[model samples]
Target chain A: MASARLPNLGAGNYFGLGELYAAWKNPEIQEMALHTSLSALGYVDILRVPAPILEEHVFPFMETPTSTTMEIAGTPVADDALMEWAVEERFVNATRVMVIDLDRCVRCDDCVRACASTHGGNPRFRRHGRTFDSMMVANACMHCADPVCMIGCPTGAIHRSVEHGTVIINDITCIGCATCANSCPYNNISMVAIRNPDGATITDPDSGKPIFKATKCDFCDGQPGGPACVRACPHDALKRVHFQELNPAGMAT
Target chain B: MIRRSALPFIVIGIATFAVVAWYARFTWLELGNPSIVTGYTLLVLMLMLGFFNIRKRLSMVPVGRTSLLLAFHVAAGLLAIALFWLHTGTLWPTGSYERILAVLFYLVSLTGILGYIILRSLPRRLTQTGIEVVYERIPAELGEIREKVEALTLECTEKTGSDTVAQHYIGTLNWFFRRPRFGLSHLVGGDAAGHWLRGPGGAARRYLNDVEKEYFDQILELGTLKILVDRHYACQDLMKKWLLVHVPLSMAVILVSIWHLLLVNVYAI
Candidate 1:
């Protein structure tokens, strides 16, 4: 856990512009891992943290004085629900994942469509997801700290990139067992029918059934810029955020 | 603010068109074929604008960001419309061969503008729906709603010795519950489903006793959910399917524009 990245990550999002510039200014922490745990900053996974430990360290942040929904003016669905859901669903299990500013998102499938274009014409995520007002936890892979999708991979085809923690599935080794698809609780992974050069579905010879492959967002692997979805959003709505930071911000319900 | 924003593209597009328009105007004054310069210019602009599709395909490459490309594509498209008018000097072309090309061009522009509007406005409206459903999953969600409605209809019959609610399901509500209904209505914000639920749905409730009314109330709640899902279906359906028209027509515009170019060079030019 590179603790030097905490103040840079907290309060302001890692994807947020000022934070990126600030991070770049500090060369020592520039090479921090995508999901750098903040234990050195005196915080661990929120799920595992005991109350007294969190109270002394993290509780100060939670004391925003604003309560849930109507109590703080009633328009919100409660920031607590957002945090609780993130903690319970393990959305923050990843260091960084796509989050949407619904206030900004125009429901343009540009992000989703751009993702598909990057990954051989099959979109890796759904724009549709759990929403709390203008914030959406879009159903894209967070490339979790512990990818549950990796549990049943018979061939060990789905693996994390050593360079960046992007979860990539090797198309060649993948057997289309659909283990990852079923195991993914968020339904981020989809089993798309494997197609050939002429746009015909490749069939399993013995079974004579259309072969499938487990597909999801690979964080635009090997691409120069970054995730195409974030780059594709004209509205500046979509962001690849540290889910750990999102919990305290309480953007979703 | 201007440099980082799409203002540059807009500024650049206008400046280039103004330069070309000025050049074409001088050529026209000299009684020369201004169509050649404006036509060629429009063709080049179309190629640049049309390359957005190609850019979409080449996402693996490091050309530029797709969002910026789209913003530029749109700015370029609008300027091309100006150049289009400058080239032809008329909105409608009289020549039969040119008319087909003109029609195709207008269709492309119309669809593109419509798509721009859809992409701009649809997302916010979708968020207002308070639920996010995948486009493909709408049918299954509808099916789930249908199942619940039918079960409620059945419960109405069983709990009370009344088939009025069941009869209502069979008669009026059945059609609404079947598949996506009133798509055009939803598209136009007609709220036909909501109106039906409130109007005819209320009318049907009058026939029910307290026990049956309880069942109807639950059915109405399910109907409301169905309406939201249908709204998602209509909007998402429009978002994806409009590309079917816009993309192919865009490609056609390219093909026809090429043929028109060859014809102008060989015969007219």
Candidate 2:
């Protein structure tokens, strides 16, 4: 039942308290206000007023009913159908869903580059995953509420971030077991062989055996203003939306 | 949310049982002849269970929540087991062909239950080990470790002018490092490799000079890495192998079940 503040209807069609008296005085303006309010409430069908009904039943009753108070009545503005569809689509269950509007997305790799640059030239997420219509929920950690990936970390290295709730692997303690990588049902986590700054494989000094660690999108936890991929999408095609907040209507291209 | 959604299904299952019980107690209808209804229900449940793989493959299509589907699949599978018990009305079948069907059915159910248990438990066991690995890449990773170990052993022999450590590695660790070993031990969470490395493998260290001892330490570290790799293979392999049992048996159950249905309709009727 979240209400949206109505934007200005048109030039000189102010519906605020400042212009309330003027809107009340003019019948044509009041009718326009009624139409706009109804439209805003998604009652477009009601606006198809027959000429006789509008002039006789509706307009005459306006003064009696008090045009000063425009009580627009219809279904609530919230799209319950869209919300239900999103939930049915499993969008609401995802923690941090990186959705791409395929229509808007030009298949440009800017988001990929942004992710790579943020994470020392290694992108944390892949560009593909399950898609519904034009919207693709890319291969990024949803930081699932029930992360199966956390089930078998012997060292307790892979854990949820206390502040942000992001699933992060503690590199120092991670034994490079790849249990988490295999456990991730979505294949979001990737096991990368550890390397020194100079690109030499980081290995035990004693054994000289190469090391590996599980890596995935951390939702750009410490980055100012949030995920670099979302920020870097020039066309606004990519967004990190909570599944619950996903608007199915917005994704309809 | 799962519990809430499952309530209706549970209620329906109870209703089905109650109806069957009432019919058996009071009605002239025979309980043995009630197999058609229950059998059909079981068949439908099996078909639903089979569709789970299809659902997984069609993730892009907006069918429904996979978690919700999985919950239904689990519940339906259990209910199907109950229906199976009721349909047969006995643990063992008398006829040979009937026995085969029952055996396949039981095997399918047993494997399904075992797979579910493993799915629930193995993740926790995997997390207990700090190392994470991709199952398919284990061989390549193991190869890298073997190469590193071999290089370390060769360097130790060259620097210290001794083949004691090198000779010991050749005799004891050569084949071990070449490929994944102690698979069954790793599967059952045994640390026999670690024990051998520390005990017999560490025995080679005493014979080595200071420089070779350093290399010995490196070889021990490589051995530890190999053990981790072995453990990964064990757990991952089991996880993958469980499906081989579960899926094919499920298919066999369905195939034998259809044959049972045809026989029941054509002759038994």
Q: Tens-digit lDDT track for model 2 on A159-226?
A: 99999888888889999899999998778899898877887778877888878889999888776657
Q: What is the lDDT of residue A5 in candidate 2?
A: 31
Model 1 lDDT on a 0 to 1 scale = 0.77
List residue ranges in candidate 1 displaced over 4 A: A1-90, A101-128, A144-161, A165-217, A231-237, A244-253, B1-5, B26-32
Chain A only, candidate 2, TM-score: 0.63
Best candidate per lDDT, number?
Answer: 1
Candidate 2's DockQ:
0.02
lDDT of 1 by residue, A130-162 (tens): 766668888888888768889879999999898
What do the candidate models score in CA lDDT, each in turn? 0.77, 0.71
User: Which one wins on DockQ?
Assistant: 1
Q: After superposition, how far is residue B123 of candidate 1 from its true place, in Å?
A: 1.9
For model 2, the local distance difference test gives 0.71
TM-score of each: 0.71, 0.53
Worst 10 residues of 2 chain B by lDDT: B57-66
